[model samples]
Target chain A: MTRNAPPPADSGAVRSAGSSGSGSSGAGRPGFLWAVPAAVFFGLFAIVPLIMVAVLSFASWDGLSDPEFTGLDNWRTLLDDPVMIKSLWLSVLLTVLGVAVQTPLSILLGVWAAGHQRNRAVLSAIYFVPLLLSIAAVSVLWRAVLDPNLGVPAHATWLFGDGNLFGTQATAIGVLVFVSTWQFTPLHTLIYQGAARAVPPVLYQAAQIDGAGRVRQFFHITLPQLRNSIITSVILMVVGGLTTFDTVLILTQGGPGSDTTISAYYMYQKAFKSFDYGAASAIALLLVLVSTVISLIVVRLSGYDKMRSTMEGL
Target chain B: MRKSRPNHLAGFGSLVWLLVVGLPLYVMLVATFQSRPDYAANGPLAFPEHFTLDNYVNDLNSGFAQYFLNTVIVTVCVVGIVVLLVPPLAYTIVRSRGRATTTVFRLFLLGLAIPSQAVIVPMFFVISEAGLYDNLIGVILPTAAFAMPVCALILTGVMRDITPDLYEAMTVDGASPRRVFFQLVLPLSRSGVSTIVVFSALQAWNGFLFPLVLTQSVETKVITLGLYDFQTERGVDTPGLLAAVVLSMLPILIVYLFARRALVQGLMGVGGK
Candidate 1:
């Protein structure tokens, strides 16, 4: 069960410390031999193209000429493109809904489940089944369910008014968000549950002795203790939200209009559908930059690097 | 000893939440057995009057077997390459000392920051130029490449848990580097390796976007694309489409059922919480 838990003592430090263990000349000389095959594969596939995407973001070639460079033209298109703007706004809305709305609900359910003696583990597994299933599958299942005429709840016509929820622009993105939230809430819960279980029992005991109720102890002790977990989950959810493609891709394909197009799908559409690789690369670049920066900011603001070095000092 | 708080309201709330999450899946399962006539007449929620295997039989006959085979091959190859490739890389990152080696590790760490979804733009060009377009090899190469950063990261973290004394003892005894790796590091890193295999397999199996962009033809289709195209082709055959969906999903679901603890724990580690 402890198969992959990171060492408690500043995992970042562990990397540096472990690296330095081979400081002597003989030890240092032998192991670079090992990193080569992987480095080659990674370089060819991951590292090179990552750099290429940045460079090619400006190269205007519609699968025709050999990618002639046109500086900032693709980016300029983004400024004028309504779909681009709509996609950007939708991405932000999705991320915000995930971070602000869904995460708190995950923590709530996670904490509630944690208090149980049995069934917690079983229930948690069932809760996360949606997460482990293919998003394509989830989208189809939900589409069928929300299909108004064919969906199960369509029989209970009174429960859902005008049941074709995916047909409208307003409800489409909202339903997409709901489906993603449904799938992921359990993951967040599991993360929170792990963090909650890690909270020492003595704190709750001490709070009880002082006559504090569950709510008081939760706010005064549990919430503060969970600060790092909360931040971790939020950044993760945001990153997930920003790059989310499958849910929207399968669920909407940026329709009943380009209404549900998040940036990821928008980039896909630009490249494959519209055959505009340059603009697609620009969108892809912006998306990675935005999401990566947000995660980095979370790391920076959380003082995790500082905490790592501080833990190393001891 | 700690006082336990009985929050009865939360208990009720969690059950409600459970039903809300469970209902759609239950509906999907019920629909998998119902005929179109039954489905249309009774609607999606009601129990199937006739539990039929006709949908699955027809679905399998309609080329799901090929899709399943492609998915199996892709997932297996990706996991195989990753499992073989990452341990050595993580070990080298852990045990090697030098500016070059450190840079190698840092580049890998940077891979975590690079989203594959974004990288797919240039990857499209790269894959096409390599003549791997509409090739499962095209899918596998990028999939393995994207999986490395996290795979290497996880293995590095796990590798660091090995004591320096273990390596020192092997080295001082004049054991070859390869000898030390095989005899000492590999066995210790088994759990870490298994965790990443499952993680990467799940990622590859569920991957929709890469397959969407990179592979063009039916011969190269992965499960994600297969399910998408199958559902659309089947038109109003919800049960058949869902039968295919369930068929596509069963492999990973079975894997998850057995490996849930490792999957969850390893994921927690991956998240670095």
Candidate 2:
């Protein structure tokens, strides 16, 4: 916790004082005026709703009538509700699968792409195609492409992997995770690619001169150099994993034993389908609390705050 | 740097590049052309034997044109508002660096960790209560709201990367903070502006959960919602529905192609990964 205080005090404080001293009186300046709309917008929309979720979670309302105070009811139900708990479990399962699959694959591709400059532009375009496509379009596109009776999967289920990908519970969530990882792997690759390219070539040359093989160079030079990027991208992966809903909504609709149902999807179903705004709000607040804690832990363990603050000052 | 030979990667990678991304895009384009009967006869993967404008024509009949317009309106408004608003905010945060600035910056950073899923619960009530529910204005407000945090954060990183000497020179010249803002800050931060513009536009364009939950009527529905409903309505007509999908993707994809490098740099710059 004290880590947040370290680098900012050293550099940030100095910068603030230096700028304030060098410039004229800072209050009532033009820049602060420019920030007013932004601050207000976030207040009304971002932070206010955040507080609203907290309050609404403790009230009973159908989103139309007056919300009456209902302390601990939603929370107690959440604790015992198998559907919500299962969805939460599924979200964690997804986070694990996503991290496990995306991290190394992206690193490898990123390394390969970093060195393979001959087709860099073309390859980047190809890879970034998925990133550019709309999520809704991606959802429908994959649905058609992966259909058992209709598309590529119909012809090559053995090689293409699943024929009835969205149909069977056993393979449904796995397939959903795979398609998602494929679509998003490019983004992770880009991050890793940027990180890898930032490393100087001299490190590799010196290691090579020391009789370090390519694999050895990768482990010692490349991996260590990319430690921050890895950690950062893992945070992206975990947050993304936890908040996943569109793919499930469009592709599976939480079908085949509700295997692909994530916490977000559960919230969506409760609020939209069952029309239980109070319970849904409870889920919302819980997810935010849990995810905030989880992300902070990830950042702490990854040394992200320590590394990034120093990096920023540099 | 010494160049490495292609080895066998040339043939293998070329195939993969074509197969992995190109195939789905190809299927989509091909499926869009084949008539309904032709689609059924040849299946989803087969090339269209008789290509026609029927799917496209049918899609326009389904009010897809209005959906396209709605998407453009919302996306452009969100992007414009974000670009116009965030720079000044980012400038103040970087230039001042006071207690208020730092606290504000931290608040924005906290928004990055909190996805819109958490806000949608209360947001639904807020929008409906304000009588903005099922309205495009309703969608635009919240979309821009969610975008503000990340946009401001990225723009701050960019503005901080501005050399302090630039500010010093402007200050020494007796430049008003307003002049220093427009005459200096704006010109220097063109790349950053474009970065947030492309970023927010993408966010708005691809926004699903918001448009899905907030907008109820067809008149207010953006293209993403439009596309989803189109698929359900025309699920049997694979090519027709896909044609609509392709149409919805075209505008954003066109922007992406021209701004690909900048988009890549923007995403990387934001450290969003």
- The top-ranked prediction according to DockQ is 1
Share of true Cα-Cα contacts across chains kept by each model? 0.62, 0.56
List candidate 1 segments past 4 Å from native: A1-30, A298-314, B1-5
Error of model 2, residue B126, in angstroms: 0.9
Candidate 1 falls in which docking quality class?
medium
TM-score of each: 0.92, 0.91
lDDT of 2 at A41: 85
DockQ of 1: 0.51
Chain A, model 1: TM: 0.86
Task: Write down the lDDT of every candidate, Cα atoms only.
Answer: 0.79, 0.79
